[model samples]
Target: MSMFILVSGPFTDGRVWNEVVGRLRESGAEAHPVTLSSRPEADLETHIEDVVRLVDSLESPGELVLVGHDYAIHPVLGAADRRPERVGRIVHLDAGMPQDGDAALALVPDPSVHELLRAEGGPGPVPSPGPAQWQRWGSTEGLSVRQLELLSRLAAPQPPRTLTQPLRLAGTAASVPSSGILCTAGGMTVELVEALVRTGPPQFRKLADPRVGFFELATGHWPMVSCPDELAEVLLRAAAGEGRRLTVPEGESPFLGSFLFDTPERPRVRNGRLDLHMPKPDPGGAQGPRPAVLFVHGGPVPPHHEPAPRDSPLYLGYARYAASLGVVGAVVEHRLHGIADYAQSADDVAEAVELLRADPRVDARRIALWVFSGAGLLTADWIAAPPPWLRCLALSYPILAPLPGWGAVGSRFRPVDALRAGGGTLPPLVLTRAGLETPRIAATVEEFTAAAEETKALLEIIDVPHGCHGFEIHEPTDESREAVTRAVRTVLAHLEQPS
Candidate 1:
């Protein structure tokens, strides 16, 4: 009852995915490789319409899944935007991430490609690549001689408008489950670099989504040609809800955005049940103590909560991300709802900080707490006391006010109250709010922001337009990615500031 509607970009055809499709079908999954429009006048919208028509033609579309490569990443996303309910998920191959309001050329990491597009200003279908086209892309995707010949022969010039027309995201498209399959065999592309960036690119922004997953193949840009079997296996796993992996791990954090190839070093046991993800130090960088970030996850534990994994996905990637940027990152597995009050959660935070401070790899003087949603409750005491060892607090769509239905407890913990009772001088704080999140709980950001102002606390609130309560963990839009990067930078900036 699921289907992978494989979408190809310009310069290629449906045949490109033939091998992957075969492998997928062999695994008992329905797969279809869609050839994009080759007409000279076809624009971005037109391309998306074509794909939509194809999906509509299906007698019974069980669960539409879009698997896009290269430029197809945009059109397929647009199709999903136009038919969100029908489309269950999307998978972005090494192809660049779609940027709403930007052209394909704009997403390329190499600016020379942009220059080339501009110099060859278009009137109709873009010209096909010369015979040397394979010489250029083949090496990147690790194309074999036959693969190069076939791709070169099938390579058709795209409609100039297709590359130029800006992508239009209806917001709903980002809400769907998504995954990224990064190609690692070729020279680093923008998509690959963005994942490791301290502040990642718009395309990689959705990586923060808790629902989205990531994978990497030890092949070139065209994994279909270079590593079809491996690519197919990953696609199958992703479709089955197991796709997220740190393709080329580095100072990667738990997704909500992550770190580089070598990041997210193997998890080491810290205090009982606490897992630490440290970034392998940069070889060329100076040797010294690094800043630290303690990530606290949110959510109330169900009566019989099902544990996902021993390692924290969001925190692991985040820790690695921080490590990539020259810092030590750690994630704590605290009792989500073991106690009636917030004291236990606060104690867990304190324990994490104590452990980090004692670690030889950490700079005890500089550490920050990056809290997500419900975990903000634990920040109350720290916000009131302003611990000297803590540099700042970065909150993501936090639940600041005390809610009656949180759990049956003695008291409804209130962050605003704690800040108000503070000595008026709190640790510098940076908070992010998803603009599109539910009005009731989302209003917590404003409420706490106002309270922080009244208490003369140093606070900065970042509003991510079109982002929902858990935007980073599900899907990312330009707004959410930028918001996360900005908040992280704020925390780092605060830490870097001379005391």
Candidate 2:
């Protein structure tokens, strides 16, 4: 027999867990749903104390399971840190594993709410989201009309400080065994986490711990309200340390599985951080230095991710393909490792460009930079002032603007804004857009296209109507192959033009 302490996240009180609590108790286990303070003055510390008090009051002799949902995870972790001995297992129910100094506001998906929390000394209680806007927090699948109504009605305004205040952990709770309950409809799954871990990020490798278990709820983020019985059953199983253990596969990442072309390997000359694939000398000998195309791979890849992007098959294939075009092909390792590291990444790319220009085998006057994915932001500076040597700038399924949770990275990363600024003559810009792009990224692409038109920039669009993001590797259709070939030849044509 084990005792469960259920804690709810923002926009709700302990009552949110009533149905789940009842089901857990009916299974012959002790269960309690804690209601955090509703006062406007209540903060994270106050909420942590509320959970601590309940833990102290519990007289059950069974194992103690601390179940935290969404924002409540902060307080639950804090309480567990103070009383590690009392916490038998910590169950993350559709909640994030926030580290010390992480604020709940950062985990929130709604931009309006994010702005509200950033406003210091603003309003009292944070207003609850309406039913129509509930999707901003998490998917509402599996929820009935009555359940949605009850959820909206019972939703309470959370204290603003509860979100704004940074979480302070003593590191004691980490030793406690843990289990994760992923909500697939809310856009996370055990398989996805496994894939990410296989990508070789050291941070995610911690999930492969033998002591940590994993489970999935097909319902949305609010599983307690939408599927209480199922949530209760998972909780009972979690208390017994019974769930799937995540594994990091020994195979290469899926993103590196395939490439558009099946060209033969070329001789690669590696510098400190750059790999240059030298093309075969012109059959008719005695030609001028060959033009080069430098490929910039996308990411917010973990800085320490093993087998850096430059070494990946996707990038190596592109380099070899470029060499086959009778021009130098280059791949550089940039530091775009995290959301906040774009500035450093820009610097790294700039250094790589200088290295390329100084190479004796390359024609510095005829160069093209082809960027992909999140690295699209790095084009802002070049867009603002098109250099004489830059013959073309190409982007594929790029992020033209920052996403919501990126905070204010300033105009440095906003390529659309740079386009609208209207500076020097823009380079021939080539853009390949995926038809089934993520909504936020699609918005940025649309915005960039509009800006390109407004500024009358020399722009060209390649439409991958049947493709999704990362189509070059994942979607190996005739369309994908043609797009890759067209984009490459187009860039080569620009490079071949007489200076």
Candidate 3:
């Protein structure tokens, strides 16, 4: 069987390649998901060495295909450069090809991105793209909650050093056949494509080379999630040495067939106090013992596993996307809110992680905690005194201050007071608020920022009203989805960073 190595982009582990890898394997390809070491503290040479090791381990006399997605184009290309003989072709899947003098973070037009890099305390040059510029380009319309969580995880502060260091690709374009899958529907523009191409090394200067190919898709950036069949076909075509334009059907719903799991309710009692509703992986292929995400639902009175409102695009959409990405999402019922108690809710998240870890199919190292609104408070408390195995966190629209009596019969919660009291160092925070400019949401974000001593980012969506708490639940307008998606993508990229 032909061998394929799938390398994921920054702020992402191997799980992001779940759909792509599954499709490749179903088509009889021997696929291996490679995890790259992307710690901001690590030097460029060290990162290159890590990829070399993985590629060498897979070395065989038979030809192999190396696929790099997004930020991974750098390391994957470096690996190919190191061992071109055993490798068959290098596929740049909607990714940027880095040259010796090109800066990785320079491509991102966000000054806040530099703030994040600086917060990470790395010695690297920050890109000058101001927050205003990035805000103009980043969009988050139609994103699911799971997608938001993925974005939040990816949105962490990146190390400035990694962005400042230029990629060093030494081979000529003839050494390997290259292909680019640009998803136009995901908001990629022809102008951006031209800019990316122009930034390539001298070897890629000749656009007419048969070995060089470019194709655009009218799907979200995550074609594997939004349009898997189309993406699979594209990969197959690339593998067969056929390069042609591939586009989604006219007026086809982008959300069709995007979710990979059945939304079944597997309610079970755990730790004698919490209820866990574990959904099965979406249809197509089940990757056993998948890494799990503990969902802490918002609302002080809503059921933990209630069907998300149709207007809330982030909830169901996010769950399905995470499952499609090979993550086992567990919605935890928290205390006094969402059908459970605060203590029990925290315990439930920990227990779910433990259970998944005990299962042989899970990687254990990739478990994550995700919560929103009131549940965000519970998640933050839990993280303050975290379990040893906790891998990362994704908290959105968090209520940092309990106020005097938020849920008490007559007491009111004062966010300002809470911020004053909880003045300790905090985890990296990704804060999102509605753009309709309500005083409450703005005040909430302002309070949280003041209390946070660690890295914190604020994503303000324009035109969203304050009452639309679950705006990201349903298919948002194109503009909102794009805004949210960009922020989420940045967060996910940050989480994928090596600790």
TM-score for all models, in order of appearance:
0.48, 0.65, 0.42
Model with the higher lDDT, candidate 1 or 2: 2
TM-score of 3: 0.42
RMSD of model 1 against the true structure? 20.5
The runs of at least 3 residues in candidate 3 whose Cα sits more than 4 Å from the true structure, single-residue gaps closed, are: 38-40, 59-61, 115-143, 150-160, 172-174, 186-204, 245-499
Runs in model 1 lying further than 4 Å from the true structure: 108-116, 119-124, 135-141, 187-205, 245-499
Expressed as tens digits, the lDDT of each residue in 1-499 for candidate 1 is: 5688998767788888989989999988889898888887788888899889988877644678789887899889889988888887898886655556656753433333444556744355555655456433323556667766777787887777887788998688778888777675544433434432322212334465666777878776778888889988999878876754334323232333322223435435466645565666568875677788888876543223333222534556566666666666677777654224356667777877888888877789998988886677777777767778788888987878643222222233578888877744677888887676554455666789899888778888898877655565444456666776787778888889776
Ordered from best to worst lDDT, the candidate numbers read: 2, 1, 3
- Give a tens-digit lDDT track for model 2, residues 61-144: 765899999889999999999999999999998887677766777567666775676677775677887777677777789988
lDDT of model 1 at position 52: 92
For all predictions, the C-alpha RMSD in Å is 20.5, 6.7, 25.0
- Model 3, 293-347: lDDT tens digits are 5555555442332233211223445554454444554554434332114555556
In terms of TM-score, the best-performing candidate is 2
Reference-based lDDT, residue 173, model 2 = 77
